[model samples]
Target: MRVPHDDGPPPPPRPPKGRKRPGERAAEAGASDMSQEPGRAALSPTVAGGEAGESLSLRPQSLAEYVGQAALKRKLEVFVRAARGRDEPLDHTLLHGPPGLGKTTMAHILAHELGVRLHLTSGPAIEHKGVLAGHLTALGPRDVLFIDEIHRLAPTVEESLYSAMEDGRIDLPVGEGTRARTIGFELAPFTLIGATTRTALLSGPLRDRFQIIEAIEFYGDDELAAIVCRTASILGVPVSGAAALEIGRRSRGTPRIANRLIRRVRDFAQVRGARSIELADATAALLELGIDSEGLDMLDRRLLTMIVENFRGGPVGVEALGASLGEPRDTLESVVEPFLLQRGFLLRTSRGRVATMKAARHLGLELPPGWQGALDL
Candidate 1:
C-alpha cells in the first residue's frame, strides 16, 4: 500500500528565512546526532561502533523488511497506517528493552513508513537545555526525533522536553541576571521516539508522556537466522541455510551479533577460497572467536567461572562480581548476564547472582555435594 504523505497542514511559521535553523546549527556544531556509537564489541547486540555504515545499510527500511518482534511489528503497522491516514504525526512512542533488538532500526522504519525525516540523538548527547532545545526546535512538522538511551537524559534536559511533547511548545530562559526572562516558543507538531535499555531509570512523569510504549524482546533463533541470511545477501556473500542457522544459534538472539558473526564467517570462507559459506565455515569461525556452542563467549565464561570457582557457585552480588572481575556493574547486568540467565546458566535471587547447575555442567566443574539442595535449585 502506498503510504500517505506527511504534508497534512502547513507547519507553524518557522524562523525567518536566512537565519540558519537550530537543526542546521546543531549539525554544524557536531551535536550527538548520530544513530549509532563506536568501539563496541562485534558480538554485542548493541550497534557495533566500528560497523556503523554497514549496519545502516543492513537495517530494514520499512516494517515489512524488519525481522522478529512479531507483536510489535503488528502494532506499529497499525499505528503507522492510522497516523498516515489521519495526516498526523504518530503519538510519542517509547521502546525499551535490551540493546541490539533493532530499536533504532524501528525508529528509522517508523520515519520511512510515515514518509518523514528522522532526527537522531541520544539522551547523554543532549548535555544541556540548549542542546535539547536545538534538537526540539529543529524538528519540522511530522518529523521523528529519536532519542536512544533516553533514560540517560539529564534531569533538566528531560524536564525541558515535557512541555514540548505535551503542548508543542517550550519556555526557555533568555538573557542574564535582571535581564533574564522566559520566552515560550510554539513548535511544529512532531513525533518523539525514545529508546532505552534501562527503562527503570526513566522518571515516571517522563515515561507517562509517551502515548505508546513497547518492549523489544530478544529474537528467536529462527528470526535471527533469517536476519543472518539477509545480512549475508546484503554483503553479497552466499550463505547456506544451515550456516545461517548455525550463526544464529550462536548469536545470543541478537541481530547485530548475528550480522557481525556472518561477516566474520564470510571472511573465513573467503580466505579458504570457498565460494559460499557453509556450516563448517561458521563453526570454525565461531570456535576461533571463542564463542561456544551455547553462545557463551570469553566474558560469559569468565563470569560463570568466577562465580563457580571463587564464589562457590555464587549467591554473589553483582557489585562483588564486578569488583572481582574488573568489569563494570552495568556491563555485567546489561551484556553478560542476560544471555546467561536466558540460557539457564545463571539465576538472580534475593541474595544475588547464582550460577546454576547447568552452568556448572557446562563448565565441567563439580559443585560441592548438597549445594543444589541448599540453593533450592
Candidate 2:
C-alpha cells in the first residue's frame, strides 16, 4: 500500500526564501539534540558484538517482514490502514514489555509502514529541554519520534513532552520577571512511539499521553524457530529445521536471544568443520556458552543455585536476592526474573521469590520436602 508521507499537502509559504526555519536556526546555534547522539545513525536493536551487531541488518523494515506477535500485527495492520485512509498521523503509541521481544523492531516497522522518517532517542539521552525541543521542532508532520526506555525519562524532560504530545506544541520558558512569558512553539502533528521495559515507572500523566498502549509478549517456540531460521537465512548460514528448533528452545522465548544463539551455534559448526548447522551443533554451542537445555544461562543458574543453597529454595525479596548475587535489582527483575517466572522456574509471592520444583530438578537437585506444596500457591 502507498502510505501517506506527510499530513496532506504542505502548508502555504510562511517564511520567505533563504530564511532559516526555527528548527534550522536552532540547529545553526548548535543546540544539543539527542537524536544526533553519537552511534545512533541507525536504529540498532542490539549492541556491537557478535550476532547482536548483525541484528541491524536483520531488523524487519516493514510489517510484512516482521515475525510473531500475531495479535499485535493484526491490530496494527488495521490501525495503519485506517490512519492512512484519513491521511493522518498515527496516535502516540506506548509499547511496554520485557526487553528483546521486538519492541524496537515494531517501532521501526510502524514508522516504515507509515512511510515517515523515524527520529530515534532514548529517555536518558534527552537530558535537557533544549534537546527535546530540538527534536520536536525538527519533525515534519506524521514523522515518528521513537524513544526507547521511556520510563527513564527525567521528570523535567518528560514534562516538556506533555504539551508536544497533546497539543502539538511546546512552551519554552524564556527571560525573567516582567518579560517571563512562555513562548509557544508549534510542532508538526507527529507520532511519538515510546518503548519501555517497566511501564510502571512512568508517571500516570506521562503514560496517559499515549493514545495506544500495548504490551509485547514473548514468542512461542514455533515463532522463535521461524525467527532463528529467518535470521540464519539473512546471515547466509544454512540451518536445519531441527537445529533451528533446538536453538529456539534455548532462546528463552526472545527473538534477540534466538538470533544471537543461532549465530553462536553457526560459529561452533564452522569451528567443528561441520558443513551445516544441526541439532548437535546447537547443543554443543549452547553448552559451551553455559546455557543449559532449559535455556538457563550462568546468571539464571546462579540465581537458582543461590536460592536453593542460601535461601533454602527461596522466599527471598528481589533486593535481598540481588544483594546476595551482587547483581543490580534492575538486572534481577528485568533480565533474569522474567524468563524464570515465564518458564515456571520461579514465582513471586507477597513474601518474596520462591523457586519451584522444576527449577530444582533442572539443576539435578532435590527440592526441599515441603517446597512442592508451597509452590502450588
* Alpha-carbon local distance difference test for all models: 0.88, 0.86
lDDT of 1 by residue, 1-377 (tens): 98778778757577797878877798746634332335322222223343676677898998889999999999999999999999999999999998888899999999999999999999989999899889989999999999999999999988899999999998899999999999998889999999999998999999999999999998899999999999987777778999999999999988889988998887777666677788988899999999999999999999989988888887899999999999999999999888888888898989998888888888898787666413534
Error of 2 at 317 (Å): 1.5
Candidate 2 lDDT score at position 161:
94
Model 2, residue 239: distance off in Å is 0.4
For candidate 1, the 10 contiguous residues with the lowest summed lDDT are: 39-48
How well is each residue in 199-258 modelled by candidate 2, as lDDT tens digits? 889999999888899999998999999999998887767789998988898999999899
TM-score per candidate, chains pooled: 0.85, 0.84
Model 1: colliding residue pairs: 38-49
TM accuracy, model 2: 0.84
Q: In lDDT terms, which candidate is top? A: 1
